[model samples]
Target chain A: MDILPQLILNSIIAGAIYTMIALGFNLIYGTVKFFDLGYGALTAVGGYSVFYFYKTLGINIYASIILGAIIAGIIGFIVYKLVYTPLRTRKSSGMVMLVASLGVLTAAQAIIAIIFTSQFQTLSINAGTERVFTIFGGVITQTQLITLVLGLGIMIVMALVFKFSLFGKAIKAIGDDEEVSKIVGINTNKIIGWVFFIGSAIGGLAGILIGFDTGIEPTMGLSLLLKGVIASIIGGIGNVYGGVLGAFLLAFIENFGIWKISGEWKDAIAFGVLILFLLFRPQGILRR
Target chain B: MTKTAKGILWVIALVIVVLIIVNVSSKGGKNSNTASSTPIKIGFTGPLTGDVANIGQNAKAAVEIAVGEINSAGGINGRQIEMVYEDDRCAGPEGVKAANKLINVDNVTAILGSVCSPATLSFAPIAEKAQTPVLSYCSTAPKISESGDYIFRDVPSDLFQAGFAAKYTYNTLGKRKVAIINVNNDWGLGLKKAFSDAFKALGGQVVLEDGDDPTSKDLRTQMAKVKSSGADLLYFAGFPDGTVAGLKEAKTLKLTQTIFGADAWDDNKIWDSLGSSADGVMYTRVGTNSSDAFKTKMKEKLGNDSIVYCSNYAYDGLKILADAIKTAGTDRTAVKNALYSIKHVNGVSSSLIEFDANGDPKEANYVIDIIKNGKAEIVK
Candidate 1:
């Protein structure tokens, strides 16, 4: 079709956004081994931080974005220390952790709504001045380009860090067996906490970019989280690189699947692929 | 006592207290038509809490103001009007529950409410079967016109508004090829269908059509598809959040097509968020003929200067029902009949409001609002 370039571009943009989410989500799941539903809400946390700092308080845009990500990371760390650490210490079931994360998500969203009033807000100061770029006859905005570059950049950096760094190997060791890692003096809890920080920071960055691209509301987190979760699962849960591959794959399938169908079926197509993966290829495209 | 025994006793106590309160509250509102001529009971339903709670609460305040004025004026035929407010949460099942409570428990003679279309439509069948005159203030779905003989709304349906937009887009804007993208919900779907039908009738081609889940903010795919279609105009339908997301997506896609929106786009929140991206975007909104006095009264009641136009319609809806009750007494059928023959009652919503044979406002008037610099001004 004459629209192939645009469709492909759309898929890649969607993929880039989802890739950021899936990366953090997969990273956290690797060590903690429980679905951190609250991780989703941190994206809104990051986006709103930028809104408050840059748009509301007149801070530098770059500084606000960095502060937004760091704030999300700190909050993620705090939640780990406060809610999840206690539960893990008590040896709670995965279901209990999942439910707790859900509570965290609900409470965080409510608190945000209380503070900011649930209004969708944009992070960009001047909407009309956005730079546009054309690649292979497909139009892409500056924000989307940044998102794509940053998403791939982050993935590569994370992959290298995991492969070559001592901290990465330690995290992998903990993921393999927390008890064994602790016995070997790798500080499982501390490493897991760092992973949470990194993962949540990435999630928040996704939210910040999304706020600039579209807009942000308190409830935007759950949907973003669901997409990331799907990407992680289908790409092989707990596998960092697999999540990245899964993110792009999911985006491509979602955009291209709806090419001949109605756009409303995008979510259905996403969940359908998730179910298919859960059924036939449970380990996904890669194994951890 | 043992822990289990204590838990069971607490549960039993709670159940008894709940039942007692329910029984007493039920008795307080019903069967009070004794020889003393008790206050006329009227039920009001709107979402006091939910996504559209702001609109619902605004309408509630307006209705309360109307009630205060009517009571100060010695009530309807010397019988003081008593209102029972129920929160439907702007949902279908909740609407049915609220309507049931109003009809069966509260025993209201008439209902002036339900700011949402789904809520209005959900309870219309019950209101019809029970012969309870239901006058909606903000519900604008076309299906409401055929809801029931007893059902009436002050606001004109999306059909007329859609027709207006279609004619304007085609003949006025001179757009022959249009793109349609709407939130996948009753309000969006209804407007999209009506607009498409009207545009097609005017010999306009719908070059691209798409619907996104109402909960989704990402309209990139839809925007991309519409962009490739090279349409001259895009008629986007969504609530505040969805509308903001859709318009922003269109901007990100760098689509050069003129953007048009439906009544839901009247929300200032959308414009506030979209900022400069909202510039040149046009939408249809019902023009209100509210007076300075009503504006002052609303400000006094709400402690704010902001006024959504639906609140004006709600105020008028209550006033119209009160007038009907004054003539027809508390009889539901008589109130319904009186409403149908309302002639030309002047109120805040409009200068002249008369119900036609189909229990709709005879005249449908809408104006185009164009946004620039994050504020909307009526262009036509």
Candidate 2:
């Protein structure tokens, strides 16, 4: 097999994962206009929940995934109600919310490490049983295929909801002006809460998919979060479609950048692309 | 001075007085120990927690078993051996702290420990400065051979394993072209250099060489590169987590190249994670010719059949140290000399062990084990 097809497939697989993360990240950022560092820890929450339900309790994989996502969504909703919402009510600055989220991220990660002992865990029931399929001379596993398909499906659904749904319109209005949206009978807090639930559920699904594809560790959330943040910034922060576009672009560049060089430089190439975009197109490839 | 300054000064003065009194009392106690019935203190450090905690804890258990046997045999010169253990967490700074505490606070005659390479390296200088011998049971980095006369290891360095692996791949397997993927760290870099040099010397070509961060979970890009490198064999140097991820990714890509690895892949967790995908993969480690009696004893002590090779080495290390102490009689210089001149010491891992000038085992046996039916079976 030619290397180009494999590289492209690798890029697509990576892009799919990044897209899922960036979509949920952008959705939350669009509504709240704050960087929720705790969003990263939710990925581990989703992965560990599945490990508990599916692996520990012997539940069906599909049910475990759904329950894992719901757990993540509920955690996200609780964080919003207890921390972010109160801070927003106090009219705190974005930096304060960012710091608070960092605190939450650190605490959650520490707790997970204490429980799981910092060991890496694979979520697969049978390690070598996953089916492989060849497409255009590129080999991909069943998990990778599901990840790509679910990533695209979720992106489209998210876009449609934002475009056509009254709830999404209410979210946009609140994002534009929270006090004005309330005066206009938008119920800003309730809509934002729903947004938090949906966005976090999507992030949780990405986590479950990634856990199945690679593996899970307590510290995996930070790296996944960084990739999603980079993609969102490169595409255009707070723009849903832009985040998706930037994700594939970042993935392609990262994969091709290391074609001849060593793999250790992959992270450097990613951050270098982000710097270039920040310098030339600070609004990203798309403007919000 | 202000009231706050005076308060602080008073506290410092009180602390200094308490320290002086404690120091004098400790010295008096040491002087009273000359009657020769006091317990001989030995300090031990290893990763009791963290990623490599299992290996460290196993080594500790082995040492404890050895100590129990020694005490039952009436101890060295009728003085019971006492071990004070500290957890270094398999990190360098923590190792340094543990060394300092063992040498300065616990006042041990010698130290045993530090299962990982970096921890052993970090503690070597401290042990050398304190004139306390350190016998590391598991650290196998090539640099440890030159770390200091006081620093010794029962495990052979990666220099031997890498050369052995390279020769096996080239001469036995007849692989002309090999690709190397390694973790970017001391052990990995050492193996990469040694393997490549040895393979090239054997008239084999290294087609591709790349490094991955130890914590990296995704390796598809690197795997794709290796797949297209036209190499018949791939030498992967990684720990358990990295090995599992890399092998899984390679299997997903259906890469047909034969995989070769180092001793770290001898772990059961890797096999558990890789399952059937681990079949046909080969790795090398220091061969253990442990007696069945010893194995049974260890399993009984640990309450499981999870004894790794390092545990055997640890058991031998404590026995050797005890012998040296018996011959030298509480003198550090005499014990060092005894260790240098020791000969034909029987160990669980080997029938005889003699230290070379560099404090590594002079002659060591290496075994190549292949994963067959998700279990490691000795091939040679």
Q: Write the residue-wise lDDT of candidate 2 on A1-288 in tens digits.
A: 589988999999999999999988999998889998789988999999999999999999999999999999999999999999889999999999999999988888889888877677889976767999888888888998998898889888877877899987888787787889999888888888988888888888888988898888787877888899999999999888899999999999999998999887888999999999889899999988
| TM of chain B, each | 0.93, 0.92
Off by over 4 Å in 2: A82-96, A177-189, B1-41, B71-109, B126-132, B301-303, B325-338
Pairs of colliding residues, candidate 1: none
Tell me the deviation in Å of residue A35 in model 1: 1.5
Residue lDDT tens for model 1, B39-87: 8889999987656677888889999999999999998888788899998
Docking class of 2: medium
TM-score of each: 0.91, 0.89
Candidate 1 off by > 4 Å: B1-3, B17-54, B77-109, B126-132, B299-306, B329-334, B356-358
lDDT of 1 by residue, A1-288 (tens): 256888889889999999999999999998878999999999999999999999889999999999999999999999999999999999999999999999999999989887876666778876646898877878788999999999999989988988999999998898889999999989888888899899999999999999998888888899899999888888988887889889999999999987777788999999999999999999989998
